[model samples]
Target: MSRVLRTPDARFEGLKDFPYAAHHLEVGEGLRLAYVDEGPRDAPVVLLMHGEPTWSYLYRHIIAALQDRFRVVAPDLIGFGRSDKLPEEAYYSYERHVAWMREWLERLDLRDVTLFCQDWGGLIGLRLVAALPERFARVIAANTGLPTGTGMSEGFRAWLEFSQSVPVFPVGMIVNGGAARELESAEIAAYDAPFPDESYKAAARVFPRLVPVTPEHASVAENGAAWCALERFDKPFLTAFSDRDPVTNGGERIFQARVPGTRGQPHVTLPGGHFLQEDCPDEIARLIADFAG
Candidate 1:
């Protein structure tokens, strides 16, 4: 797993003073995990996992707001953010993702976690929780789903094709296009903080492509196994999916119907697109804190 580390200047220059303890953990032979560890050491943990294109930076505002009360731990997944970049598309599989995250979590000894997952975060994070349900206290899913491939929205398919065919995975520019509001110059650059170029975007390029479109996908059976575990996961579960985000719209309904943990919970409709944190961090934070109570 020998890998290249992308040292994006904008990421470091702009975020040098951000209020979080940045740490990198050795997860595998060539993979190192980059994460922000903040707030009281004794506070209950809120583990945040991001999706495609964006890194841990996506949670900056939410981290700041909640770190004061909870120990926030958000990691940049291997390909998308400030973590190691492997150029091989073959290296970027659903199995690799779950394996990488599990190794990192085991190394960090993460437990009693209030897991918050969005986008790919939910895809990978739900597998983590389902694999070892004892480690988590509750689960808050926002604009994310653990796909079992019973139905995938057409919006997701369109975006999936775009990511695979693009010459360069412009993390920042693509993110701006998806949002309802125009991003400021600083905000756009902030999203681009991770990758210096296309060389660092293998994870972003392959993540969308890795989503199981049909039950025959390589990891479909594994996802089904996770779903089987989730069928009886009687824990605190809340869904705060956004009203926009065509790609993931109604995904919460699938979880609510199948996952026992989400039964009878209030489903929140937030005002934003796919990257709702960029659109309404304050509201998302409020919902998490309110639900965690």
Candidate 2:
């Protein structure tokens, strides 16, 4: 059995601009995934998935903006935010992340979901869409991809090197570095809140390496299979990639080229960095609202 670590409740106190109440779902034995579910339960479900080194707090502004019109559900992927964390990096893997989320989704019985995924959120969320395409109504992929062991970009290569070589994993600073604008102290602190110490950071530290950037990478075959599903996903798939994100700047081209759903969609380039949620929350919310409608 894997040992789990949960951040103290005290650490999340007084977070800036994040006022949503947390709800939990038991995903595995003794493992509870944390999420923020807002708006009317009967409303159209909008699932927001966050990416590396960030949590549901990344979607606070987006949630607030869309809650009035949609059922906004944002979950902190295991090892981030209020969710349970594994101390050992060996406990984390691309397949395991997908399994945990699959369980969470099944338990929630969320159907006809409109997914908004970024970063690793896209990596994992796209896989979920591929696995259960029937459950999703549409998709809004931003700053995320489902790599099938293809070569990575120069920016991603540098990020992989830095993540592996950096002695102290600074979660908040990493997030700020990915944003187009500087973040406030409290906002930075909220990014750092879920991680009380280095021990709570194994998943964050391991996520970059988990990206299947080379043919030898573990999830290459699985992502390839997912791509087969995505190719047939003839739903309204929109690519809302950001302009300034070096890591995934032109990444949307692949989806547009391959996914049948990209045909006739008004794909766009938003103004932000890698973490566009922090840089353009309201715009993202508006984009999602219009797209889901």
Candidate 3:
């Protein structure tokens, strides 16, 4: 195993509106994954999965809204938030991420889950649903998808280019750019907390390039297989896409058209940018709770 770095607890101190206690589980040798497990233990599980350059903190407001009535589990992907970071970018891969999350899910024994995933969250979470269809009761896809590399959006293309060329990966600023509204300084700093320095950003910096954008891409076959399963998924599926997210503006239509569960559902276009959780957490949380019902 490559050398891994764990962010000190001090960095996460004083984060605004994110006060949930941190829980850690070992997903790999020398790698510990951090997540927030809140609400009633017996309540139905509502899994909130975040995206690139962000972590469980991205869902704080949403968590606060749902924890009273539902069990909310939000984990920081490896290399983000309180999770252990791989020192080398090469250690991060689409398949590895899926595997890590798959193991984590099985370890937790989560069932009857209602998944709300965005960006990379969708990419991996959708695959998890496909892999363990019986575990998922429903899905709420927000500004997210499982791409089979047929086409690339212009907004995504720009982001791909920028992620590669940028010398320093500004975790917080990158998130702010993705959101419709500017994040407060403290919030932005919270996003940066996981990465004490540039070396800690290896996974974040490499995530964009790992996206499958061609037929021969590493994850294309798996994602295509996932799409096949999703086509047959008869469970409830909702698309709560945002109105201002250029990167995923029209992406929801693809899910609506392809996934059998999406038909006749009360899909909605929410107001905000890519990170709608930041712009309208309460609304999104309510929508998710209602959809899960």
Candidate 4:
């Protein structure tokens, strides 16, 4: 584990109650990527990738439920949760994020993966799948989108603006925004646990800005390439988004329209805000298992 994962917040020490066993894969160059490698190591793998402001911790319930039948490997994307954070903005870019995760995957040598991505997880993970389709067998995306933003709604625009302009890094508010209801005190603290102060929050604070909200944004060309690749992605694909999330409503339509194997699979609208897993983990887990079947 890198020194960066060891935060001043001791509250996460109690997170051992979660079923997945922790492991660190040195993705090289002082980067010790933290992941929960659970269930049988030989079981077919499902790679769960999280989005902005959240870590692999977001998938705790899903991990517990699926680890018994499937090998669950969920990594804290460099800078978000237990992974190392680069205090410098220069280190965090869409291209850089893609490359960094490419290295992370190379270290694991994961094959025949079923990708489970939400929020920015879908953004990054999908690009990875497009880049190396052979490594992944299937994909399930929730409350997430490719974010070409060419055909996105005005609501998304307003939210993008608000996220960038917000002065304080309101981790609690953002997490609670997608939550089905008010968060418990402990859960709120868990979201707030990674940061000792503003310094440790560079990644959380920068995530919203990293999203390509407009057609001309910096990540546009890269996502365009990924989309072109996805157009021909012939593997099983599914979308499980929240009905109430205005930010991503109809986003799945793009995937269904574009991706090859997404034609007949179940695409459901789960109940909750942005963070559907926190609100309704049981349904999400069952749906994912059913997808696996």
Q: Pick the candidate with the highest lDDT.
A: 2
Count backbone clashes in candidate 2: 0
TM-score of each: 0.95, 0.99, 0.98, 0.92
Kindly list the per-residue Cα lDDT of model 4 for residues 94-153, writing each as its tens digit: 777787788888778988898889988988999999899999999998888876646556
- Candidate 2 worst ten-residue window by lDDT: 21-30
Best by TM-score: 2
lDDT of 3 by residue, 89-153 (tens): 99999999999999999999999999999999999999999999999999999998788878788
Off by over 4 Å in 2: none
Clashing pairs in 3: none
TM-score between candidate 1 and the true structure? 0.95
Ranking by TM-score: 2, 3, 1, 4
Give per-residue lDDT, candidate 2, residue 212: 96
Whole-model lDDT per candidate: 0.83, 0.94, 0.92, 0.80
Off by over 4 Å in 1: 8-10, 16-19
- Stretches of candidate 3 exceeding 4 Å from the true structure: none
Tens-digit per-residue lDDT, 1-293, candidate 2: 58889999889888999988889998867698999999999999999999999999999999999999999999999999999999999888999999999999989999989999999999999999999998999999999989888799999999999999999999999999999999999999999999988999999999999999999999999999999999999999999999999999799999999999999999989999999999999899999999999
Those runs of model 4 whose alpha carbons end farther than 4 Å from true positions after fitting are 1-11, 16-21, 149-152
Alpha carbon lDDT at 289, candidate 1: 84
As for lDDT, the candidate ahead, 3 or 4, is: 3
